[model samples]
Target: MTKKQEYTGDYPEKTLYLPGPTEVREDVIEAMAEPMFGHRMDRMTDLYTTIVEDTKDFLDTDQEVIVLTASGTEFWEATTLNLVEDRMLVPTSGAFSERQANVAERLGKTVDRIEYDWGQAVKPDDIRDALEASDEGYDAVGMVMNETSTGVRNPVEEIGDLLGDYPDTYFVVDAISCLGGDYVDIEDHNIDCIFTSTQKAFAMPPGLAVCTVSDDAYEREVEKGDSSWYGGFRRTLDYYDRKGQTHSTPAIPIMLAYRKQMKHMLEEGHDARDERHREMAEYTRDWAREHFDLYPEGGYESQTVTCVENTRGIDVAETVETVSEEYDFVFSSGYGDIGEESFRIGHMGEHTVESVRELTDAIEDVAGL
Candidate 1:
């Protein structure tokens, strides 16, 4: 008789409390262990090809989604090279978005930046004003949906509406850290381009980057007269066109795992997943506010993760290490220069309310807060 592979809590697992690679469900992990299929085979095309199509339905878009064997950063180059000709009017509220502008500048494109104070959102009015003020009407405008740096969720829907009639400008979003937990109405919102990585909220291991491009953007890529082939939109488009295949042997396990993850996300329902994320965020934020200041403003906070200000003066690194070594629960120190004064805790993916409660309990016990 074959033994069933099941995991019990007799031995605690390494529960991730930081952002990016959150905790995936047991079923999803098993799904990833499926035998590898040939990338050149029809079976591969059928399985992953469906994932690409289903992802479009999930996003409520008629746009063609190009799955790349790269991170979301590649789309920065793809978007800039394809749609952008001259200058980019980029607005940033955190580190990641700032890097997008930097990518534009590095590519020799003139970049006009609209930067906001850290821990704040890029407001719709700011976008509207910037678009109106641009004498050249900007080649494109890009922003991040959820800034992982400070746990601030940007108001993307509002900003999208602000750029409604600007047919000449491309509205691109870096939706990496918020895809599964965050609900984005792509078509109704009139988003020109939406890019996301698989690791964060998709409940899959990293290696794939997804982008949904509008008909306008597709035409632009097609008309760009061969800017780039490798890691470019042309290669992705051609792979789908010629053989219904990916550019390379994909992270086969991750692709298979995504099938299960997507099924679970859909079976459990998008509304439920989104509500749970919001619930967890609210609970964590309420607790954090009572204990320390929120990194972002009170009204504007992230639903997938929370960045908490350290008011109790506990050594964050010491506390994190102590808790991790003691209980096997890992958390995040503040990023970049703010590592000492801040910390982050992710509450997305397969984690339940009970799980979050356990995480909170561990923090309270270890730090005596």
Candidate 2:
């Protein structure tokens, strides 16, 4: 006789208020349930073209768009692999930004960095100083538009304006946490390459990494033969131009979800979406200040996530666990060393100010503050 195993097929439903992999829309999830199709078929081309064109229109940029079945980290390596010829200048302000510099070094590229204290935004003047001081000059400058760890939004536009003088040096931005929600003018800022993950602000399930590549970046890669054969900007863009589909197999199910979600995003329009994120940030910041304090510098807090300082000396992990157990809601503690001293509340994606209030109210109830 076989022994019966105990099983409880039930899982606790949590409304994610964490940084990445935030709450996914029900319809978006269902979209992935769509029937499978052949990747080489015309139908795949239609799906690929629709999402690519829609993303370009949504971002209001004429640059090439590449959607790969990978995380935003893939672009970090791809950009380093393809564009950087000699040395790359990276600004280190937080965990993710520092990791970008580290990735470049691991790829055997010379990495020059302008370091800042964690929670502080990268100073554009400091970047200009680094560029001015570098006698040999750098091939590219990498930065994070939003530092997810400490919840600081760097002045990418100001840094981009500074880069305009150094035309030979390309500018790359990691907009993983901010793209769809923050409303950056990529073309106007002269940003050569910027990438994001769908799980962050696109309000979709994870798997796809979307990137915008400028003509300058493409041309530079073309000059360097055999650069990043797999994820190269020119190769991907060329394949899309020829067949209107990805060079490699893509996550078709996720693309179906992306098609559906991007339609909703385009309908909402960039102005409205950006305004919504701004409102959520303002509301979250106001709430944090009321209960505790913001971890990031003044006037530079992230529009997507708010890292609240433990001014009242509350147990952050315990408070988070209690709130989750009581209310079936979840947010994040700070990243790395600051995890115990600070907590994070994500306000991006499809989250509304009303939804954020629900989590805040639950936290207050649990913390008794």
Candidate 3:
């Protein structure tokens, strides 16, 4: 029999530079330690409503927001079940976007993909071509705003604008890694549904997913009559309208943390946060260009995470380990097929350009850049 190892809760505190589970603020962490309350209690309602409304304000959107105790992946399934009745269009660029399409397929929906190279962006023209080429109408068109695996930022706004032409086809975007940091005009862009995770640009701990649902998308789910019980827009939003809490029991501690972090987010302001992230991305890309090269195509790079091509052919895994062990700075190697060929640096979530340079400096020291 195999023996299980016990956790001692003693470990080196390394700064996170990975795509997700990014470094959360100390106060946010402390907020999670608040006393627990019953889900039905007024305190729970206060916590839930605060975060939901704050999120709407943070995004500058009038669309209904849903906060659930799940990863951003939950919306991949939820959007599929709610919006896509029989067919959806997904433009595959990187791992995350591909997975979303796969989720729809697994739900027994026919998924048509306009494939792009991992580092290439999803073009709106291609989406238009796909829609025009198809004789049958699609129920939804889904795409990832930022492909974390390859650092490609698809032009979701352009696609959303084009989707406006196809009124019958709803537009759903998985903005899990860039939503809070990137300034997306959700309503102006005609996006039907957009979702994200707290751990990414929100700079909070994992276990909460946030999404904005347009009235059209919500009504479509209602008409479908067969939707995810836990993730249904009708179930969650209607319950919030009546009880001011999640339909299911939520992670109250995380809600506490969310409330705290959201206050910080509001103070920072969405446009300011977007500019900060943009500066970090510019700095990271400059550094990458100097020492290595960027993995993603030019002009479509992600602002939250930067994937550096291993141009100098340094040992990515070894350098990551050495930086963590020696400098207590943790970054990420490339994801999936690009593993070892590239490395990723997460710059979102409370991290400034000065702090990001600290990791790059450590990398240069360890990798002999």
Steric clash pairs (candidate 3): none
Best by TM-score: 3
lDDT of 1 by residue, 221-328 (tens): 677665556556667777787877888777778888777787877777777888888888989998898888889866779988899988888899998998898989
User: If ranked by lDDT, best first, what sequence of candidates would result?
Assistant: 3, 2, 1
- The residue ranges of model 1 lying beyond 4 angstroms of the native Cα positions read 1-12
Each candidate: RMSD to true structure?
Answer: 5.5, 2.9, 1.0
> lDDT for every model?
0.83, 0.93, 0.93
- Candidate 2: deviation at residue 300, Å? 0.6
TM-score of each: 0.93, 0.97, 0.99
Task: Compose the digit string of candidate 2's lDDT tens values, residues 57-80.
Answer: 999999999999999999999998
What are the per-residue Cα lDDT tens digits for candidate 3 across 128-214? 999999999899999999999999988988899988899999999999999998999999889999999989999998999998999
lDDT of 1 at 209: 87
